[model samples]
Target: MVIYFTNQTGNTTDASVSSFTSIPVLDYTQALSPTTKPKFLAQLRDALINVGFLYLQNPPVSVATQDALTQKGFELFRQPLEKKLEIEMVNSPHFLGYSRLGAEITALKSDHREQFDFATELPAPGPDEPLYRNICGPNQWPDETAIPGFRQATEEYLSEVDALSASFTALIAESLDLPPTAMDGVFDEPQQHKLKLIKYPLPPSDQTSDGAGFQGVGAHKDSGFLTFLLQATPHRGLEVQNKAGEWVSAPPLPNTFVVNIGRALEALTGGVCTATTHRVSLRQEYFIDADGKPLGPRYSFPVFQGVSMDLSAENITLVVPDHIRDLVKDDKVKSDAEATFNKMFKTSIGEGTLVARVTSHQDVGQRWYPDILAKALQGQKDFVSKQ
Candidate 1:
């Protein structure tokens, strides 16, 4: 699939798979300035339609704030194993808490990373409420005495990123040649966004080079609208798959966030905007120092901008222009069979999200929602059998 973009010289150029190497870097501040806004949007449009991933520079969050958040993540990971287990995700019905290494599954395989997940604090749903509403609830935070100021730093970062995501969503609407607020109605009041602090530890020396245990996180498309990832380390583990099924490296850039379109956005845009496949492959080199000593683990913080849980097929109203819709590629890479079940306009967003959560964290599901877990597993098997 070749995507054409107008370059600075006003000349059209094709971004073919062979020519697509690195992720495009777009300055967020440029999108704010009147003179540069047009150029930024053009680049953003191309990035979204073609690569589905880009490095965002000069984002709303300050360097100090990002550094503090990164520091807090490191501190949180350094805590005793017992402390982390105390707030294990298995204990949370909402799936908001710490997850030890290999606790989460992706692509039906264990992801070789430990993570802490949290979202906007909200009260649990009432007994008579729909089952999908169980996804909304307060987060399980670590002990403040053990990690002082960690909560403050994380919340501050989330607040700043929330504003940035909302602003970016508007820009995305404009980029699609729609009204700036065209997609605003899809977001719920007090939007429920999720953030994760992940640490991809070094694989065993013997397994690093082999294909045995290198998956930090298996290839998959994010289920939300957008994902703003802070690659808090100087390692090359993240890889984005192009339309041609080739993996392109997305290395870390200072003061930048690697932003990617998600499935919800793709569905909202009628496939005009893509949700690219990406994964993190663990390698010994990525965690070794120049002196050959281990440099600990690779850390990353990714925040997923959430949409309304009630959003369903009936709620979709935005229509992509004919010219823009023509840009949709026919040869786009397909996601895993299990993931394809989450397509928007087929079921309510909350329903799909709940199934995915229950499938991924079955321990939590078994304890809090055994029935849902069994149904989700059966659903996956049924879907896969048909495919």
Candidate 2:
């Protein structure tokens, strides 16, 4: 192994000791305190340096709240296409809203279901920071009519994870062998971050007819510092390919987020970490009854934490590889987040990208989508009552 000081990615750990096919159970609050900080940072550094996936459990948010969010999301998704269409993602141009399959695409392929995407509170950067000057803005919330607590819940989740991000980033600064508050100035204003609730519905087995991929979110590593993900396990959907090119399951855990560092983080650390490849394929389970049988739904919420576009999470030292140390800007560098995020959603300049491309009818979703879903559920209850 070419262990370069600049190359902080060091060596990939023995998966035999840390590999995860089953769910990982961990409590962030306990794992993140100052006393355990050293050990936790070492483990975290190792995980990012090798496994690239950390399963978490017992996050600050309760199971009930998360379940409620999921329940409300599915109910809203089932509402009349007309009612849900009222608040379209296209309305904001930043691309926040509900999107059906074909609305989101990754790796140049379209995804197979609907989802909601929103970043946490964004701060305006200085005039010199070109990236944030335009790209940073408050989230575009759906009108309360769609779902009374939708915006509030979404915002709350963001806050919870945002705090987690702050905690983790501080630890990372320490793991870099710097002072406790080393990263304070680095991520001064709330770090540029986002929170998402993605529900991958059971696609019709016959969905080959559609251009979308048979999988939910495709195999793609996050492009930022770190991602904390919570998923439903036993359902068997998430997969991460190892350095050996082997595919493994990312099963659900009780409460943790499946965390991983992105390429940018690797770049920041000067390759001291691993940003392993991951992907979701069309399930090949043999349908015993017949074709077109639907499987169960799969849900995941991945909260991404990042530094300002101008702040590089990576600041390699001379002890590291020259290439690694070079990642830090000797002179001011620009952040790629603005263009990258804009392109991901294909929205107007500075408007964050929606998950998928906009067709003629789908215009607004955030204006009041959450309320629409609630109303849809009410109608369902009413229908059942009448029956």
Candidate 3:
């Protein structure tokens, strides 16, 4: 059941809140069935083309498993500050591990949430491998003694989401009127998947000054193919930007996940599906703790599934159907699609994501990846500076 309130997107103008329309909801069970597939595909296409966001009901992950993971997430966060810091992200060149509060910068501002990121548990790349391959290394796990079942629950949950995301990608291909397996190349073996365990610390006050208050997380768009977010608590904050530039709040619903397209999909489709921008905001009630206080942290688990990092442009197949390609008549979009295609073919999705990380989280880049950070800055200058 998707509960959409009559809340106007943030931009609605009225003495009383204007009624905003609800985002579309897709029934995952029907979507995967032969009998209901055509209808499901039609709705899926409509949802992606129109809103680029939707509520996925009856996901592959069970409610009980989700609850177990949520409890584990809370347990991990509840560890003593010293214990939590043992696997700090700054220590990992691959950008795995925990990020303390105020460490992640977004939209040129500090995000008020701390998070732990885990990716495919692979071995560290050899020294001779491409620097970007460094991101493919093993994740930094918390001490099982300190947080028993944390690793087991997280790994299990990630595996479930990973399988579901792969299945959904094939459905996306079907919805686009392509061969059901047309999107398979993106998820070739060794594809990188990330699960983020995030906790948004409650704001001291409503003030938006000195970076001391709630910028729970600044506005941004996901950079991967598809993102599935599981909200453990009912604390409201997540909002999605609509076509009219209004921000609509997406509150938590039982057995539903708020899914959104990411930048890679937008590039791959030549703008047919958008990479919608969204952000998090905090309300006083949800701010259960005072500044420097910890009442109960708001937790969110977002799983990002993207193409194989090693995939190059030459090996990548852009899946925009001819009809969709014909619809992309805008010269700029065409150019961007071409450029992105060429860049990815030559480098890889792994490189693109790495560049994005360094650009957004400069401190992380500077500390753990200074060499790559310098190269990125040089590339930026060459691209934008007067010739």
Candidate 4:
């Protein structure tokens, strides 16, 4: 159960200070059965409202496909350093390519993980289009000869998960007491989605004095509508923050994806759905061998479900029932300064998305969007000074 407290500003804070142990688990197969759909919806509603995270069992993607995709990840990262650098993220104006370990920053600190970012392959926008239109572009792929079947496997997995995420989103709409098609308008003809293949390496000995080293990915909310994460290793690293400001462990479970709501959904839903902050803090033991030597890196794959770039708060008209709206605190989920820049009403989805990309991957910004990057950096500096 969740507990909430109201501040003097009249905004409610979750304050879920109880022994909130485990993330709720929901079975996807049950959602397909007429007899069990109600129960599934009830469980989903609670998970969406309170935790904003859950373990999804028996999703559309099969275990074999999952294994294939992960195997490709291992192969991709195993390529020689020079070969990996061939498609480095700096080469892509769209920010779609490989990012070296500690190359990406979050919350002003370098994240200690190497990752490859890609999205639904789309052509670059025309020159006369809006600058945010640049976000849609082709990806930098590795040599097919070096990694046989890598592209095929990844594309297949992406296609399967894309369908799954869309169907699941419809279920989310139903759980919110809205028509299943309530969110249909927030998507474009060719929806834009993104995926990441991440590797969190073992921390150096000197950095592990406190047992935990640098952050794998810093504490932040996803900018999309939903995120389906496949934790491809046994190591425990991912953690979710509760309303009480406590970090709860979210370890890998067999044949299940750890799904979470994202900031985009929270904005479109008018705060009816929550988007909790989460981070990955790497522990030495998580990547240590029995002999105390370094083990292999921890791997994970997360697919971010996208929304229409044209969407903005001023145009959003999805109505939340009064009773459901009452369950949420005064439509103020987070009071942080960054939230201001991320709010849909403050900026269009495309602009907000571009700012986040430019800020996180500065190399892409410097190479492709210098002007916007300067403003973004100054804004961040201004926010930090105020804090």
| TM-scores for every predicted model | 0.91, 0.67, 0.86, 0.91
Per-candidate Cα RMSD to the true structure, in Å, reads 4.6, 12.4, 4.7, 5.2
lDDT of 1: 0.82
The C-alpha stretches of model 2 lying farther than 4 A from their native spots are 1-38, 122-134, 186-188, 206-213, 232-234, 282-295, 312-387
List residue ranges in candidate 1 displaced over 4 A: 1-19, 208-213, 289-293, 329-342, 382-387
Candidate 4, 1-387: lDDT as tens digits: 122323323554332323234577788999999999988887788777778888888899988889999999899999999999999999988889999989999999999999999888899988898788888889898999999998888888888898998899889999989999888888876887788999998866656454344688888988888999999988878888777676777878787899999888877766667888899988777786557776678999999997888777667778868777676653355343136435654767888889999999999899999999999999999999999
For candidate 2, lDDT tens digit of each residue in 24-101? 333466565779656666655555545667665556666766666666665666667766556545554434555665
Judge candidate 4 against the unseen true structure and give its global Cα lDDT, from 0 to 1.
0.82
Q: What is the C-alpha lDDT profile of model 3 across 1-387, one tens digit per residue?
A: 223455542342321112224566778999767899888887777666656788899899987789888988888888888988899887888888888888887776778888889987889989898777787789999999988888888888888898888788888888888887887876647666888899987676645654223678888888788999998877778887665566777777778888889877877776666667788876555544335343466888998877767777577675677875564444654565566656655777878878878866677799977887899878878876765
Relative to the unseen true structure, what is the C-alpha lDDT of residue 59 in candidate 2, on a scale of 0 to 100?
64
Candidate 3, which segments miss by more than 4 Å at Cα? 1-5, 9-21, 209-213, 285-295, 324-346, 375-387
Q: Sorted on lDDT, highest at the top, how do the candidates line up?
A: 1, 4, 3, 2
Cα lDDT listed for each candidate: 0.82, 0.54, 0.76, 0.82
The local lDDT score (0 to 100) that residue 125 gets in candidate 3 is: 86
Clashing pairs in 4: none
Q: Write the per-residue lDDT of candidate 1 for residues 1-387, one digit (tens) a residue.
A: 122333323544344333355578888989878999998888888888777888888899999989999999999999999999999998888999998899899998889999999887789889998788889898999999999999899889998998999899999988889899899899888888899999988876666444423999999999889999999988878887765565666778788899998888877776667788899988777787677777778999999997788898777788778787666545332232123434654678898889889889889989988998999889888998999
